[model samples]
Target: MTYIVAYIASLIVFGALDAIWLTTMTSRIYRPVLGDILLSDLRIAPALAFYLLYPVGLVVFAAMPALRSGSAGTALAHGALFGLIAYATYDLTNYATLRSWTLQITLIDLAYGTAVAGLTALAAYQAARWVAG
Candidate 1:
């Protein structure tokens, strides 16, 4: 029950923030750098899957620990760490395999992921505590 609430809260908050970042910020920032490699039309399926699935990782790795400890700080720290690792995995793999991938983009993405996940986890943990009470 609580876990479900936490998951939903994390998903909603993170998804919204990520959407805003993608539409308003990242598109402009990356378009110039990625240029031709940037798809004009986004593939909805993978984007949707990423939003839906990524929250599960947050719930399990960050929210759960914070809930158990009754500490939002725990969520923030763990969530940031989780984000760093997860984003690094994607970006580093791209850097390794994709000729078009850049260190600038990878660094920017890693920073964004870390902040977004940490903040989302904090919000989710707080929401769960509110719901539990």
Candidate 2:
């Protein structure tokens, strides 16, 4: 039950936050920089796969461990590191291979990803605590 709560909370918080960021930034950030490479429409399957899978990673790697340790700081720290590494893996790869990818985009994504993941982990930790009690 506690782990379930943590997983759901992580999913909801991260999903909601990232949805807002993607919708808001698609025009202002992504399109401006990646317009040439941008598809006319988003591919739903890949997006759904990523959205669904990422929270599981967060749950196992960050939230679950923190929940076990009973430490919110652990959740946040691990989650942030996870986010940094995950986002960097994607953004840096793009920056390296794609002609249009930029430092600004990579840096911005790193910041947002780290912040959101940490916040999601904290939220998940709190939710798990509430459920366990």
- Highest TM-score, which number? 2
Per-residue alpha-carbon lDDT of candidate 2 for residues 58-115, written as tens digits (9 for 90 to 100): 8888988998999999999999998998999999999999999999999999999999
- The TM-scores of all predictions, comma-separated, are 0.94, 0.96
Enumerate clash totals for all models, in the order shown. Answer: 0, 0
Global CA lDDT computed for model 1: 0.90
- Candidate 1: Cα lDDT at 19: 87
